[model samples]
Target chain A: EAGVTQSPTHLIKTRGQQATLRCSPISGHTSVYWYQQALGLGLQFLLWYDEGEERNRGNFPPRFSGRQFPNYSSELNVNALELEDSALYLCASSLLPGQKNTEAFFGQGTRLTVV
Target chain B: SQQGEEDPQALSIQEGENATMNCSYKTSINNLQWYRQNSGRGLVHLILIRSNEREKHSGRLRVTLDTSKKSSSLLITASRAADTASYFCATDAGLRGYSTLTFGKGTMLLVSP
Candidate 1:
């Protein structure tokens, strides 16, 4: 089966501009999660969407927001991007909650470069 | 932060040897998972150990979790060049019925032939 898929493998945006990253979860998956892996910053959770609802988010600012569509695909929007916003944004998908031994599958991620 | 922190930020070992990495988290979790990420690639799930479990093994990988200490360890035996990558430990806090994961900074392992 095809794993999670992300669009525009790489993106470049100028400071103060906005950027949008997209992700399509694996088939039959209902939960999509966004994560930012900035250089030397590790992997930070950005948002979590389940059943078309925002379930949880990390300590990131409001500028980092995203939404999940009816089909379980997700879009992450970074508003007024800053140099610090440059990072590899990853998307992962997993089975619905309450499932036993649930494991998340990740996409290759989009490399966002903010100048 | 509830994120896990990996020990020995980086490690170098000769191929065919064993490599071990440790992770410590700040909060109680429902499960702990290990992931491997090669350069410029997405992470690959390695193993998952639940809070109730102590140790588990898959192929040549062994994972041990000490809930009392809120620490976990991963051991890769007979390592190969293919094993060189950054290893991260993620915790599923399972807070409010959400399976959200908090990841560690990761340990970089380099295996030379």
Candidate 2:
């Protein structure tokens, strides 16, 4: 089975612009998570979506938002982007909680560069 | 905020040697997982140790969890150049239903051949 997949491996946007990143989870996975890895900042959780519902979120601002589709794929949209928003955005998927396999599988990530 | 913090931010070792990284978290966790990331690419799940478990081993990787100390350690034996990557420890803070993992800053391991 294919692991999680992300599109637009790299994206470039100017400050105040908007950026969108996409992710498709594994075939049988039902939970999708987004993380941001910035230089020197480490990996930070952004959002968690389960069964098409926004389950939890991180400390990020309201400008960072995303949604999970019916097919379990997810899209992350960053509006009014700032230079600090530039980072490697990763998406991961796993079996829903209470299932046997809850280990998350991650995508290659989309590197967003805000100029 | 990140719940876990990895020690020795980075490590450099020779192939065939052993590499050990430690992680410490603040809150109670249901399970702790280790992941490996090559360069800036995606992360690969390495191992998971539940709260009730103390030690677990997989292939050349051995993970030990100390719930009493709120810490965990990952050891890679006979390391290879291919094992050079950033290793992170994540904690599942949720106790009941779902779990959202909080990752640490990660330890960068460089194994020289």
Per-residue CA lDDT of model 1 for A72-98, tens digit only, reads 999999999999999999999988654
DockQ of each: 0.57, 0.56
What's the C-alpha lDDT at position B54 in model 2?
99
Judge the docking of candidate 2 as incorrect, acceptable, medium or high. medium
TM-score of each prediction: 0.96, 0.96
Full-model lDDT for every candidate: 0.91, 0.91
Task: Summarize candidate 2's per-residue lDDT along A1-115 as a digit string, tens digits.
Answer: 8989998999999999999999999998988889999998889989888899888888899999999999999999999999999999999988864453268889999999999
DockQ of 2: 0.56
Candidate 2: lDDT of A3?
88
lDDT of 1 at A34: 89
Report the Cα lDDT for candidate 2. Answer: 0.91
Candidate 2 regions with alpha-carbon error over 4 angstroms = A98-101, B96-99
